[model samples]
Target chain A: MVNRCLITPARTLLTQTINPSLRNGFPAMTEARVLVLDADPLPRLDRLGARARVLHTDEKSLAERLPEADVLLVWDFTSDAVREAWPGPGGRPVWVHTASAGVDRLLFPELLESDAVLTNARGVFDQPIAEYVAGLVLAMAKDFRGSWELQRQHRWQHRETFKVHGSRAVVVGSGPIGRRIGLLLGAMGVRVDLVGRRERTGDPDFGRVHATGALPDLLPEASWVVCAAPLTPETHGMFDARAFALMRPEAHFINIGRGQHVVEDDVVEALQERRIAGAALDVFAQEPLQDSSRLWDAPNLMISPHMSGDTFGWRDDLAEQFLDNFDRWYAGEPLFNVVDKKLGYVPDH
Target chain B: MVNRCLITPARTLLTQTINPSLRNGFPAMTEARVLVLDADPLPRLDRLGARARVLHTDEKSLAERLPEADVLLVWDFTSDAVREAWPGPGGRPVWVHTASAGVDRLLFPELLESDAVLTNARGVFDQPIAEYVAGLVLAMAKDFRGSWELQRQHRWQHRETFKVHGSRAVVVGSGPIGRRIGLLLGAMGVRVDLVGRRERTGDPDFGRVHATGALPDLLPEASWVVCAAPLTPETHGMFDARAFALMRPEAHFINIGRGQHVVEDDVVEALQERRIAGAALDVFAQEPLQDSSRLWDAPNLMISPHMSGDTFGWRDDLAEQFLDNFDRWYAGEPLFNVVDKKLGYVPDH
Candidate 1:
């Protein structure tokens, strides 16, 4: 997800209530009703001011509001509330857009069958998530957590760490985010094998993009196995006990993708039994994982909340991207980052 | 250190005693006596067997053995025994080499004035240290420490972290190590300003290597300030309070160079005052940095036991490197990493 760092007047005008139609390029989107599924510290959609009748709703009110809206903005991408409160296929908005890259949460049977077009905030998160993955890889390889622990004890113990250079990594996602991760890791001297939905050759970035089925063969050879795949039926629970068994004892595992992509119990068991070197999870099966969960006690495991793609000023970037797409929608132009409801992600073309 | 992952026969023959002279391309040098300043688990110099009389000595026995040895291999590079036991200009080994990058420990006035040639393991540590520094930069930018802390408390907290890409780094030290660091960071999309003792232009890696005098101007703009400079009178205590004060509040300071380059107390004060965002020190003025040292409690300060360049198999690499240089010394070929004693480093060619 590589968002253009747009330098637009809306960045400054976000907090203000201004008639956006007077702006140079934006035409009024009159007669359209926009329904926002709200979260705390609501998004600055003032950029769409006086152009459409914007309505805000929570999980409780979303179903009733769905029938009247012309456009549905899933601002609270974390919620599965939309799925639970979704109106029937016939009453839904004409267009549905999620403020996130993954459309997994929104892919209910009704929504998938609905005529409403699906789009997502895809490009905004690519680079940030890639940087985060690289950081995790380095942290695990260098034993930074061990260093911090040693520092806490005021002990100066020297340990020989693993080198990131010349190491092999299998990145299980050939999307923009995974591609960026491969590029950054490659920059650090890592040999990256990117895995896509299907086998592809002569990729501009990765010379050979292996298919998902090739993971079993690739797992044993990699020093790192990263999960960045979209959460589709075929991808869900792809990294289970068998997958962990195939990995070398020295290899590390990292997941910045949807939690469903990994079997949490198997990873926890792998760490406890020392089957793998270590693991870093930025996403879990249940985000804000319950405090009583066994994951907190998993040995040699690093757990970070699902904030990999959210860097400082990320909200501003997301907002800008949404507005840009909104402008295209208003002009009767085809939108960017349209997710294929059946596929659960924008097909890599 | 960037030790070559050598696949020589010696790697397997290391533990066994063998007459190395029978090996291809190696000539016997029975006249030379080599003294190894030893540490626990002595280096496998079996490759030197029967060629030179090898003697292992510790700090107490070093001065007594100095007169008998023709060559001094400072295997225990951390020890200051050489400086304390040096027999002065009248009686000294013809050549001295440290199995480490910095020659600060061996740069005593007597040795500098003597005819003995000093060489260091220069190329070995360059790539490893660069990788370590890059790791530290990514770790700090992504707030890995904070994530670890939250994970420890079973807290699922999401925080926006800084992006490493598009950040500026001021790397002080235009040597191989610094150059490599700049290259790796540049690969991560960071703009690097490499500062050297003297200004240089059109450097094959870094186009314009700024002089040390430009540091103050560069400091305020950098998100990271890295010290990889060799320790010399001119560079000693260079990163003091003034340097920290000049840095942006968001900037992180990293020291992979000699501890003397930084005034420890000044850094302690800066960290305590929250003048800088964070810091990571792999070297301290007095290491195994005393248990009572205030650095341990310094907020956001990451401390390690001077192991930045020490990756797994580093010792073997160092041993092999020393033996490689030994081959040149025995052949009477000019040494590869001959240090300019007056400058206290291998001058950049």
Candidate 2:
């Protein structure tokens, strides 16, 4: 049955003549095995053709199957099974790719030190996530929640809402997603202060990209503070009590990066105490956030499932992106969106 | 007692020399009596100085005071008392300035037939209403109402949302308010078709402005259809059953122009039958929509109490705008935003 599912394409001759992997002692392209960490609604890998052997495994079987594959496709990106199964494997794949922008789940010490090249779906989520963040900013400013509640009561209460233009924003992270967010907000007439890992001056769009260290000064002045940084050791819990405390009472915070990037308790406290105007979290420390979580009922809070970048047909986008990278891998070409394992993200030049 | 509130400034000396109304059989600028139709939290007219006598009147007293005033300030722009009392007992004011963008209420036959020059609060609400409309567009596209419902239930249901960047919009009304809406939506990467009374091509921002007659063709292609046209005889009830039928099933409608621009029953029917995806109405066929209205229960409908343009400090912005025009009126120079009675709006050049 497995043999019938695999293709015997005419490209076998092409692989032998031009493929550089043969010179590196790697298996012939046709013999390369790809193990996809299976999740519900599996990826469409029909484009792989007969160039590679494909296998599927759940968390329970991943470790046992790791040694048999030349490449690992982390299709269930939300699972941390790879971190646990990496060490138990007899030998790891030469390449590991995740269907997500963040490489945090695969950032275990062993993987970071391994010879495997890690790649991510970095560009896929940038525009969609940026749009989601902008929507949250506008939602909070316009008090749509209040309007919705009033609509339910069939009341005609007229209230003045805030204006989005002329507002100030502090976008934490200089990546494509964060920069895109900055650009969208700037287009809406917002004054955007982009904060990255280090200070960068003379940016054509933002004029000056402030370093993470400048966040303290930027926080108090910003009406909208967004977190889109990678979940590195330096960024984990970056928006803790101290960071939330520095924000103005009327400031709003939006988190679309990773759950660990925020200390959930601090956000709940801020909302409970009305220290901040409001907060919107598309991610949580432990998601599916427990039903008993206090964040659920936090005042002036908006909680959405981790779907900021999941626009219609996004799965297809991810699958197509992976196929393009697969084509490059089959041709012995360097993969796009290769993450710097130490940084846990694809660093911008 | 009213004289105590009036300013007896040196401007009275300057008024006689430059005021052109004096030559037109109108009252001298300094002798002008201003009647303000009052509402709660009345306007600050301290800037009017000592040049004119300012009198405040409610609906009951408006008719009695109409003949005594040479200028009328429609401070309570929502009142229709002007329509009912216009032909009652006295001559109308030489000039009427409404603190609102829409002059639908002041467009009564008597006012339109009279020589009274009408001006509106045009530019004040342009940016704010545009932002409000943009927010509604984003809110609908992102399914924020769904998120809020899920959040209330503490459910984590991940769903794909629609993208806004590539969407199309049809913005009715080519006046400043409509143009501003088109520009802002255009900046957000939406393809906007600005519809006016006549077809206009080669517009710098919008290459072509479709005539109102083209709405049938445009509605089917638009994901967002906005109504910002003046509520003239030709425009009243324009968004009727036939118009709603032309819209795509996934298209959303937003009305911020005037309540009468839409036929309430048609909108309710469109939402009830699910003919349209959704709608947001800042202005309804009636203000302070009654608690018993059927529109309150319409599906996929968002209703606000006509506060789209009333952003924070908006009243102050209105007052300041009127004062600038009042300065022009006092100097006998042409006033900004002077309405064309025949068109029922400030005609664009």
Candidate 3:
């Protein structure tokens, strides 16, 4: 026999946040108080605010308030508070959502084993990140840094630059973001090889996604080695000294994925030794990278704060996504973008 | 008369230069004396060496030798010697070719009115320029300078960025490069309006290419205004104060075409006044832009020494293109990429 579930009137924010275009489900649903761990002001959640109580907090106050909130909105995905505080319960929330695609920080054993459902802002960042990656490819191939340096010195030096067309790129990931990247690169006449965790076929974006086993063979042939994979036990430190040694000397590396997906020390060493042509990293193992990090001194490396996928209206997109999911949950429907807790990411299929 | 024209064995370079893929048309054609005005070493013409007497000259000695040449190859595309020396009483060659897309420097009245047919390296630079312009757009939107500056200081600062998708763009030349830029930008989801000299329809890349007359209406709505028009009597200084004024204050301007297309003083003024957000210029009114130029200090302005379309091995591509056209000329066939003398550019059709 199936049991009927009911939330108190105070938790309706969960119901209202779902796509408003979706039929209102479970009328008179409880209005749960939402604890928002914010780094900065999020896009105003007018519809959700009208339906539920949202208590804004920060990394400092997140732990103290975790027990009182009925729901947790990890708006400040960069914080580790959720992992640190989840075990301390007044029981954890029934569901947890992060305004980020990577959930490495929220994958602690306790939460992974918990009954809580996890969701992330996925679709919103995919296209933007793909666009960013495309830009990175062109920027590197065109020697934009050299151009910028010349401009700085008021120098007018004309030099030969490499072209982006007909080049080979191996994108490491088979998720929507990775596929979108491949699609955009392919649109520009680049031959793209997409690598995923397992062998796959029949993908429209990547006709036949290669498995991780193919990486060794693929690396040497790629002029562009892009890391867009999630940070999991298998992926963490995958791009190490050995991986760098496998790449062609002229190949460039770009990371729009988790920093842990690459070994920081190894990347630095390779860059310093010129093991690879260059690297453009938008994510780092330790963000707001330590002021003394030697990676800054590595020749031909470009470091960007983790804003590869955050475009002008990104916050709004994140908020809207959450609302849509909330609506589905309110209607007693399964949530979209649900993460496979054991795998540490949402399975593409 | 279908009579075979004989070329003296000494001038074989002129006939041998044609693409051998042309079935060795008009066998034993006239070996015409070929004059190359070069600032740098011209590509070694191995095949042509046996068929033509190649004469290499620099700007200093160009006039002295122009009268005796049967054909002219302006390998020093940047020099004005061709235009300045064309009027000297010595007869001009039947055909002249410049290793560049822009022929402004060679558009003197004497050459245009003469029987000389002109050709240029058109297709080679199209894709490269398109890629460069796309890079510039991303660079400006991503605030690459700020990121570079922060990287220099080993400081990590994350800031919000505008999205490329959904933003509107106005690309001011509907030539191959401009259309390719529009195509790539469109692939990234940006709405682009391509402007040409006249209204055109049914372009596979851009459904409708707007005419210059649409600028007044389109500029104000554009967030990115790109100038890729060639320099001509009708185009010189076209982007003046009035053009800048018509654009949105948040707009960014990119000039990958001839620098003379924009009025330097007006651009600097607009940048200083924050009339437009920023600009990236790969070309200038005077190249090797005078180090003392005030534009160096203009806020939100990026400058490069006119190398947008040149990629590695570009010299080879130019040589090959020239040789292909020469083959057609050798066979008395119509040449490709013939610039309309009256219009100062190759007509799109």
State the lDDT of candidate 1 residue by residue for A1-349, as single tens digits. Answer: 4222222222123111223453344445344578999986688888887766789999889988888776789999998988887887556677788999888998888888876677888878888899888888888888889999999988889999988899999999888888889999998999999999989898888889999889889999999999988999999999999999999999999999999989999999999899998999889888788888898879999899999999899888887888888776665556778787767788775
TM-score of chain B of each: 0.91, 0.91, 0.91
lDDT of 2 by residue, A244-316 (tens): 9999999999999999999999999988888899999999889899999998999999999999999998888
- The stretch of ten residues in a row with the least summed lDDT in candidate 3 chain A is A1-10
User: Candidate 1: deviation at residue B177, Å?
Assistant: 0.9
Residue B220, model 3: lDDT of 96
Judged by DockQ cut-offs, the docking class of candidate 1 is medium
Best by DockQ: 1
Candidate 2, RMSD to the unseen true structure: 6.0
Write candidate 2's Cα lDDT for B290-345 as tens digits.
87888888999999889888789998888887788777666656667778777888
Question: Which should have the higher lDDT, number 2 or number 3?
Answer: 2
Docking class for model 2 is medium
Error of 1 at B83 (Å): 1.4
| Model 1: colliding residue pairs | A1-A123, A1-A126, A2-A123, A3-A123, B1-B309, B2-B124
- Give the candidate order by descending TM-score: 2, 1, 3
Give the Å error, residue B131, model 1: 1.7
Docking class of 3: medium
TM-scores for all candidates: the values are 0.92, 0.92, 0.92
> Scoring each candidate complex against the real one, what DockQ results?
0.74, 0.73, 0.65
